[model samples]
Target chain A: MRLARVIGTVVATRKEESLIGFKLLVIEEMDPREERPTNNRLVAVDTLGAGEGDVVLWVQGGAARVISEEHRKAPLDVAIVGIIDAVDIADE
Target chain B: MRLARVIGTVVATRKEESLIGFKLLVIEEMDPREERPTNNRLVAVDTLGAGEGDVVLWVQGGAARVISEEHRKAPLDVAIVGIIDAVDIADE
Candidate 1:
Protein backbone atom coordinates (compact mmCIF):
# COMPACT_ATOMS: atom_id res chain seq x y z
CA MET A 1 0.00 0.00 0.00
CA ARG A 2 1.15 3.57 -0.80
CA LEU A 3 0.26 6.81 0.96
CA ALA A 4 -1.63 9.68 -0.60
CA ARG A 5 -3.90 12.57 0.25
CA VAL A 6 -7.32 12.93 -1.32
CA ILE A 7 -7.37 16.19 -3.23
CA GLY A 8 -10.80 16.21 -4.86
CA THR A 9 -13.63 14.16 -6.40
CA VAL A 10 -14.34 13.25 -10.02
CA VAL A 11 -17.91 13.59 -11.29
CA ALA A 12 -18.37 11.36 -14.29
CA THR A 13 -21.98 10.78 -15.25
CA ARG A 14 -21.00 7.88 -17.46
CA LYS A 15 -18.02 5.61 -16.97
CA GLU A 16 -16.98 1.98 -17.22
CA GLU A 17 -19.83 -0.42 -16.45
CA SER A 18 -18.01 -1.91 -13.48
CA LEU A 19 -17.69 1.49 -11.77
CA ILE A 20 -21.43 1.96 -11.64
CA GLY A 21 -21.70 2.94 -7.97
CA PHE A 22 -18.22 4.03 -6.95
CA LYS A 23 -16.63 7.34 -6.14
CA LEU A 24 -13.69 8.42 -8.27
CA LEU A 25 -11.29 10.76 -6.55
CA VAL A 26 -8.18 12.73 -7.37
CA ILE A 27 -5.22 11.98 -5.17
CA GLU A 28 -1.64 13.19 -5.04
CA GLU A 29 1.00 10.63 -4.24
CA MET A 30 2.64 11.12 -0.87
CA ASP A 31 6.37 10.82 -0.75
CA PRO A 32 6.92 9.81 2.87
CA ARG A 33 10.65 10.22 2.49
CA GLU A 34 10.20 13.82 1.44
CA GLU A 35 7.07 14.16 3.63
CA ARG A 36 5.11 15.84 0.87
CA PRO A 37 3.00 15.17 -2.18
CA THR A 38 4.74 14.35 -5.45
CA ASN A 39 3.72 15.24 -8.97
CA ASN A 40 2.29 11.75 -9.61
CA ARG A 41 -1.37 12.59 -9.29
CA LEU A 42 -3.97 9.95 -10.18
CA VAL A 43 -7.64 8.98 -10.04
CA ALA A 44 -8.67 6.25 -7.67
CA VAL A 45 -11.90 4.52 -6.63
CA ASP A 46 -12.90 5.38 -3.06
CA THR A 47 -13.91 2.21 -1.27
CA LEU A 48 -13.41 3.36 2.33
CA GLY A 49 -15.30 6.65 2.04
CA ALA A 50 -12.23 8.82 2.48
CA GLY A 51 -12.86 12.56 2.43
CA GLU A 52 -10.88 15.33 0.91
CA GLY A 53 -7.73 16.21 2.92
CA ASP A 54 -7.60 12.71 4.45
CA VAL A 55 -4.39 10.78 4.04
CA VAL A 56 -5.04 7.32 2.66
CA LEU A 57 -3.52 3.99 1.81
CA TRP A 58 -4.10 3.04 -1.81
CA VAL A 59 -3.54 -0.13 -3.82
CA GLN A 60 -2.80 -0.19 -7.51
CA GLY A 61 -2.94 -2.79 -10.32
CA GLY A 62 -4.56 -6.22 -9.93
CA ALA A 63 -5.19 -5.99 -6.21
CA ALA A 64 -7.21 -2.91 -6.97
CA ARG A 65 -9.66 -4.97 -8.96
CA VAL A 66 -9.96 -7.54 -6.19
CA ILE A 67 -11.43 -4.97 -3.84
CA SER A 68 -14.75 -5.43 -5.58
CA GLU A 69 -15.70 -8.51 -7.57
CA GLU A 70 -17.25 -6.34 -10.21
CA HIS A 71 -14.04 -4.35 -10.35
CA ARG A 72 -12.12 -7.55 -10.81
CA LYS A 73 -13.57 -7.68 -14.30
CA ALA A 74 -13.15 -3.98 -14.92
CA PRO A 75 -10.17 -2.04 -16.24
CA LEU A 76 -9.64 -0.11 -13.01
CA ASP A 77 -6.05 0.30 -11.96
CA VAL A 78 -6.18 2.08 -8.60
CA ALA A 79 -8.28 2.05 -5.43
CA ILE A 80 -8.36 3.56 -1.97
CA VAL A 81 -8.47 0.74 0.53
CA GLY A 82 -7.81 2.45 3.87
CA ILE A 83 -7.85 5.84 5.47
CA ILE A 84 -4.57 6.40 7.28
CA ASP A 85 -4.57 7.18 10.98
CA ALA A 86 -0.84 7.72 11.33
CA VAL A 87 2.56 6.99 9.83
CA ASP A 88 5.75 6.23 11.69
CA ILE A 89 9.13 5.89 10.00
CA ALA A 90 12.64 5.55 11.32
CA ASP A 91 15.31 7.76 9.76
CA GLU A 92 18.01 5.29 10.62
CA MET B 1 0.51 2.20 -21.96
CA ARG B 2 2.81 4.77 -20.34
CA LEU B 3 6.15 6.08 -21.64
CA ALA B 4 9.35 5.97 -19.64
CA ARG B 5 13.12 5.98 -20.15
CA VAL B 6 15.29 3.20 -18.85
CA ILE B 7 17.85 4.85 -16.61
CA GLY B 8 19.87 1.74 -15.75
CA THR B 9 19.75 -1.90 -14.70
CA VAL B 10 19.41 -3.29 -11.19
CA VAL B 11 21.81 -5.89 -9.90
CA ALA B 12 19.89 -8.13 -7.54
CA THR B 13 21.58 -11.46 -7.03
CA ARG B 14 18.68 -12.86 -5.00
CA LYS B 15 15.04 -12.11 -5.71
CA GLU B 16 11.55 -13.58 -5.85
CA GLU B 17 11.21 -17.09 -7.27
CA SER B 18 9.14 -15.93 -10.26
CA LEU B 19 11.72 -13.38 -11.47
CA ILE B 20 14.57 -15.89 -11.62
CA GLY B 21 15.61 -15.24 -15.24
CA PHE B 22 14.31 -11.74 -15.90
CA LYS B 23 16.23 -8.48 -15.93
CA LEU B 24 15.27 -5.81 -13.43
CA LEU B 25 15.59 -2.23 -14.62
CA VAL B 26 15.31 1.29 -13.26
CA ILE B 27 13.04 3.63 -15.18
CA GLU B 28 11.99 7.24 -14.77
CA GLU B 29 8.47 8.17 -15.82
CA MET B 30 8.23 10.34 -18.93
CA ASP B 31 5.64 13.05 -18.40
CA PRO B 32 4.88 14.00 -21.99
CA ARG B 33 2.67 16.84 -20.87
CA GLU B 34 5.67 18.43 -19.22
CA GLU B 35 7.96 16.97 -21.92
CA ARG B 36 10.40 15.71 -19.28
CA PRO B 37 11.01 12.97 -16.79
CA THR B 38 9.09 13.33 -13.55
CA ASN B 39 10.26 12.29 -10.10
CA ASN B 40 8.46 8.92 -10.37
CA ARG B 41 11.36 6.51 -10.60
CA LEU B 42 10.56 2.81 -10.26
CA VAL B 43 12.05 -0.64 -10.69
CA ALA B 44 10.38 -2.88 -13.26
CA VAL B 45 10.85 -6.36 -14.66
CA ASP B 46 12.05 -6.19 -18.29
CA THR B 47 10.09 -8.55 -20.53
CA LEU B 48 11.51 -7.16 -23.76
CA GLY B 49 15.13 -6.62 -24.73
CA ALA B 50 15.28 -2.98 -23.75
CA GLY B 51 18.64 -1.32 -23.18
CA GLU B 52 19.63 1.68 -21.14
CA GLY B 53 18.48 5.06 -22.55
CA ASP B 54 15.67 3.35 -24.41
CA VAL B 55 12.20 4.85 -24.16
CA VAL B 56 9.75 2.07 -23.38
CA LEU B 57 6.10 1.34 -22.69
CA TRP B 58 5.35 -0.21 -19.33
CA VAL B 59 2.25 -1.87 -17.89
CA GLN B 60 1.19 -2.00 -14.27
CA GLY B 61 -1.09 -4.42 -12.33
CA GLY B 62 -2.44 -7.86 -13.30
CA ALA B 63 -1.52 -7.30 -16.92
CA ALA B 64 2.05 -7.22 -15.70
CA ARG B 65 1.71 -10.72 -14.30
CA VAL B 66 0.07 -12.02 -17.47
CA ILE B 67 3.34 -11.62 -19.41
CA SER B 68 4.59 -14.90 -17.96
CA GLU B 69 2.68 -17.75 -16.39
CA GLU B 70 5.38 -17.91 -13.71
CA HIS B 71 4.66 -14.29 -12.87
CA ARG B 72 0.90 -14.85 -12.73
CA LYS B 73 1.09 -15.79 -9.03
CA ALA B 74 3.94 -13.44 -8.10
CA PRO B 75 3.70 -10.13 -6.29
CA LEU B 76 5.18 -8.15 -9.16
CA ASP B 77 3.60 -4.74 -9.76
CA VAL B 78 5.28 -3.44 -12.88
CA ALA B 79 6.82 -4.66 -16.16
CA ILE B 80 8.45 -3.23 -19.27
CA VAL B 81 6.54 -4.50 -22.31
CA GLY B 82 7.84 -2.57 -25.33
CA ILE B 83 10.74 -0.43 -26.51
CA ILE B 84 9.35 2.63 -28.22
CA ASP B 85 10.35 3.50 -31.81
CA ALA B 86 8.93 7.03 -31.73
CA VAL B 87 6.24 9.31 -30.28
CA ASP B 88 4.09 11.96 -31.95
CA ILE B 89 1.89 14.65 -30.38
CA ALA B 90 0.11 17.69 -31.75
CA ASP B 91 -0.53 20.89 -29.80
CA GLU B 92 -4.10 21.99 -30.13
Candidate 2:
Protein backbone atom coordinates (compact mmCIF):
# COMPACT_ATOMS: atom_id res chain seq x y z
CA MET A 1 0.00 0.00 0.00
CA ARG A 2 1.01 3.66 -0.56
CA LEU A 3 -0.06 6.99 0.85
CA ALA A 4 -2.29 9.21 -1.25
CA ARG A 5 -4.79 12.03 -0.88
CA VAL A 6 -8.17 11.94 -2.55
CA ILE A 7 -8.36 15.07 -4.68
CA GLY A 8 -11.54 14.65 -6.73
CA THR A 9 -13.80 12.09 -8.40
CA VAL A 10 -14.01 10.32 -11.76
CA VAL A 11 -17.13 9.72 -13.84
CA ALA A 12 -16.85 7.08 -16.52
CA THR A 13 -19.83 6.74 -18.80
CA ARG A 14 -18.57 3.36 -20.03
CA LYS A 15 -16.58 0.85 -18.01
CA GLU A 16 -16.30 -2.83 -17.35
CA GLU A 17 -19.65 -4.41 -16.52
CA SER A 18 -18.29 -5.66 -13.20
CA LEU A 19 -17.16 -2.13 -12.24
CA ILE A 20 -20.41 -0.36 -13.09
CA GLY A 21 -21.38 0.88 -9.65
CA PHE A 22 -17.98 1.37 -8.08
CA LYS A 23 -17.14 4.98 -7.16
CA LEU A 24 -13.82 6.16 -8.53
CA LEU A 25 -11.80 8.77 -6.66
CA VAL A 26 -8.95 10.79 -8.11
CA ILE A 27 -5.90 10.62 -5.89
CA GLU A 28 -2.58 12.41 -5.93
CA GLU A 29 0.36 10.36 -4.79
CA MET A 30 1.85 11.40 -1.44
CA ASP A 31 5.42 11.24 -0.22
CA PRO A 32 5.74 8.69 2.57
CA ARG A 33 7.91 11.03 4.64
CA GLU A 34 5.39 13.75 5.48
CA GLU A 35 2.40 12.86 3.28
CA ARG A 36 3.20 15.78 0.96
CA PRO A 37 1.60 15.52 -2.46
CA THR A 38 3.54 14.32 -5.48
CA ASN A 39 3.19 15.09 -9.15
CA ASN A 40 1.78 11.66 -9.99
CA ARG A 41 -1.93 10.95 -9.81
CA LEU A 42 -4.15 7.85 -10.08
CA VAL A 43 -7.83 6.91 -10.10
CA ALA A 44 -8.75 4.46 -7.38
CA VAL A 45 -11.93 2.53 -6.57
CA ASP A 46 -13.55 3.65 -3.32
CA THR A 47 -15.57 1.15 -1.25
CA LEU A 48 -14.80 2.67 2.17
CA GLY A 49 -16.81 5.88 1.86
CA ALA A 50 -13.70 8.04 1.43
CA GLY A 51 -14.55 11.58 0.42
CA GLU A 52 -12.65 14.35 -1.31
CA GLY A 53 -9.48 15.53 0.45
CA ASP A 54 -9.34 12.41 2.58
CA VAL A 55 -5.95 10.81 3.17
CA VAL A 56 -5.95 7.15 2.17
CA LEU A 57 -3.86 4.05 1.73
CA TRP A 58 -4.14 2.69 -1.78
CA VAL A 59 -3.05 -0.66 -3.28
CA GLN A 60 -2.21 -1.48 -6.85
CA GLY A 61 -2.17 -4.39 -9.34
CA GLY A 62 -3.66 -7.79 -8.57
CA ALA A 63 -4.57 -6.81 -5.02
CA ALA A 64 -6.68 -3.96 -6.33
CA ARG A 65 -8.34 -5.89 -9.13
CA VAL A 66 -9.48 -8.74 -6.96
CA ILE A 67 -11.90 -7.32 -4.40
CA SER A 68 -13.41 -10.76 -4.00
CA GLU A 69 -13.24 -14.25 -5.45
CA GLU A 70 -15.97 -13.42 -7.97
CA HIS A 71 -14.30 -10.13 -8.99
CA ARG A 72 -10.88 -11.63 -9.55
CA LYS A 73 -10.98 -10.77 -13.23
CA ALA A 74 -11.96 -7.13 -12.76
CA PRO A 75 -9.84 -4.71 -14.82
CA LEU A 76 -9.29 -2.31 -11.92
CA ASP A 77 -5.69 -1.38 -11.18
CA VAL A 78 -5.99 0.78 -8.05
CA ALA A 79 -8.15 0.68 -4.92
CA ILE A 80 -8.44 2.72 -1.74
CA VAL A 81 -7.30 0.14 0.80
CA GLY A 82 -7.81 2.24 3.93
CA ILE A 83 -8.33 5.73 5.29
CA ILE A 84 -5.54 7.05 7.44
CA ASP A 85 -6.50 7.89 11.02
CA ALA A 86 -2.99 8.57 12.33
CA VAL A 87 0.64 7.97 11.44
CA ASP A 88 3.51 7.37 13.84
CA ILE A 89 6.89 7.19 12.18
CA ALA A 90 9.53 6.27 14.71
CA ASP A 91 12.90 8.01 14.72
CA GLU A 92 15.80 5.79 13.82
CA MET B 1 2.32 -3.79 -13.89
CA ARG B 2 3.94 -0.34 -13.89
CA LEU B 3 7.02 1.04 -15.62
CA ALA B 4 10.16 1.55 -13.54
CA ARG B 5 13.86 1.89 -14.22
CA VAL B 6 16.10 -0.15 -12.01
CA ILE B 7 18.57 2.35 -10.60
CA GLY B 8 20.57 0.17 -8.24
CA THR B 9 20.71 -3.08 -6.30
CA VAL B 10 20.02 -4.01 -2.67
CA VAL B 11 22.23 -6.24 -0.51
CA ALA B 12 20.53 -7.50 2.60
CA THR B 13 22.69 -9.64 4.86
CA ARG B 14 19.74 -10.88 6.87
CA LYS B 15 16.23 -11.28 5.50
CA GLU B 16 13.34 -13.71 5.32
CA GLU B 17 14.35 -17.26 4.48
CA SER B 18 12.37 -17.22 1.27
CA LEU B 19 14.08 -14.00 0.17
CA ILE B 20 17.60 -15.05 1.14
CA GLY B 21 18.77 -16.09 -2.30
CA PHE B 22 16.71 -13.56 -4.23
CA LYS B 23 18.29 -10.57 -5.91
CA LEU B 24 16.80 -7.25 -4.82
CA LEU B 25 16.70 -4.26 -7.14
CA VAL B 26 16.25 -0.63 -6.16
CA ILE B 27 13.81 0.98 -8.53
CA GLU B 28 12.75 4.58 -9.07
CA GLU B 29 9.13 4.93 -10.12
CA MET B 30 8.27 6.39 -13.51
CA ASP B 31 5.46 8.50 -14.86
CA PRO B 32 3.09 6.72 -17.25
CA ARG B 33 3.74 9.31 -19.96
CA GLU B 34 7.06 8.75 -21.74
CA GLU B 35 8.37 6.88 -18.69
CA ARG B 36 9.69 9.97 -16.93
CA PRO B 37 11.37 9.29 -13.59
CA THR B 38 9.25 9.96 -10.49
CA ASN B 39 10.40 10.74 -6.96
CA ASN B 40 9.18 7.48 -5.50
CA ARG B 41 11.62 4.62 -4.87
CA LEU B 42 10.98 0.95 -4.12
CA VAL B 43 12.97 -2.21 -3.41
CA ALA B 44 11.74 -5.14 -5.45
CA VAL B 45 12.81 -8.77 -5.78
CA ASP B 46 14.29 -9.60 -9.20
CA THR B 47 13.54 -13.14 -10.21
CA LEU B 48 13.69 -12.24 -13.91
CA GLY B 49 17.39 -11.35 -13.71
CA ALA B 50 16.76 -7.61 -14.14
CA GLY B 51 19.94 -5.56 -13.82
CA GLU B 52 20.63 -1.97 -12.88
CA GLY B 53 19.56 0.63 -15.46
CA ASP B 54 17.02 -1.77 -16.97
CA VAL B 55 13.52 -0.46 -17.64
CA VAL B 56 11.20 -3.06 -16.18
CA LEU B 57 7.58 -3.65 -15.27
CA TRP B 58 6.82 -4.29 -11.62
CA VAL B 59 3.84 -5.54 -9.57
CA GLN B 60 2.93 -4.80 -5.97
CA GLY B 61 1.21 -6.60 -3.03
CA GLY B 62 0.00 -10.20 -3.40
CA ALA B 63 1.08 -10.45 -7.00
CA ALA B 64 4.60 -9.71 -5.83
CA ARG B 65 4.71 -11.75 -2.65
CA VAL B 66 3.34 -14.91 -4.21
CA ILE B 67 6.01 -15.81 -6.73
CA SER B 68 4.75 -19.38 -6.54
CA GLU B 69 2.57 -21.53 -4.37
CA GLU B 70 5.53 -22.36 -2.14
CA HIS B 71 6.48 -18.73 -1.60
CA ARG B 72 2.96 -17.47 -1.07
CA LYS B 73 3.66 -16.49 2.52
CA ALA B 74 6.73 -14.43 1.68
CA PRO B 75 6.80 -10.97 3.25
CA LEU B 76 7.87 -9.22 0.05
CA ASP B 77 5.69 -6.40 -1.27
CA VAL B 78 7.21 -5.86 -4.73
CA ALA B 79 8.55 -7.88 -7.66
CA ILE B 80 10.07 -7.19 -11.04
CA VAL B 81 7.37 -8.64 -13.28
CA GLY B 82 8.89 -7.96 -16.68
CA ILE B 83 11.45 -5.93 -18.65
CA ILE B 84 9.78 -3.45 -20.96
CA ASP B 85 10.64 -3.89 -24.63
CA ALA B 86 8.67 -0.93 -25.94
CA VAL B 87 5.75 1.34 -25.13
CA ASP B 88 3.20 2.56 -27.61
CA ILE B 89 0.99 5.36 -26.29
CA ALA B 90 -1.54 6.04 -29.01
CA ASP B 91 -2.59 9.54 -30.02
CA GLU B 92 -6.08 10.43 -28.94
What tens digits encode model 2's per-residue C-alpha lDDT throughout B1-92?
88888776534343334445666666778877867988777667788888767889998778786677533544456788899888888887
Task: List DockQ, one per candidate, in order.
Answer: 0.07, 0.07
Model 1 chain A: lowest-lDDT 10 consecutive positions: A83-92
TM-score of each: 0.52, 0.54
The CAPRI-style docking tier of model 1 reads incorrect
Worst 10 residues of 2 chain A by lDDT: A83-92
* Model 1 global lDDT (CA atoms, 0 to 1): 0.70
Error of 1 at A88 (Å): 0.8
| Residue B59, candidate 2: C-alpha displacement in angstroms | 8.6
Model 1: lDDT of residue A28: 94
When summed lDDT is taken over every stretch of 10 residues in candidate 2 chain B, the lowest stretch is: B10-19
- Model 1 error, position B50 (Å): 32
lDDT string, candidate 1, A1-92, tens digits: 35688999889887777678888999998864344987789999885678899877565777566544566777888877556554443222
Output the lDDT of residue B59, model 2.
84
RMSD of 2: 10.0
lDDT of 2 at B71: 39
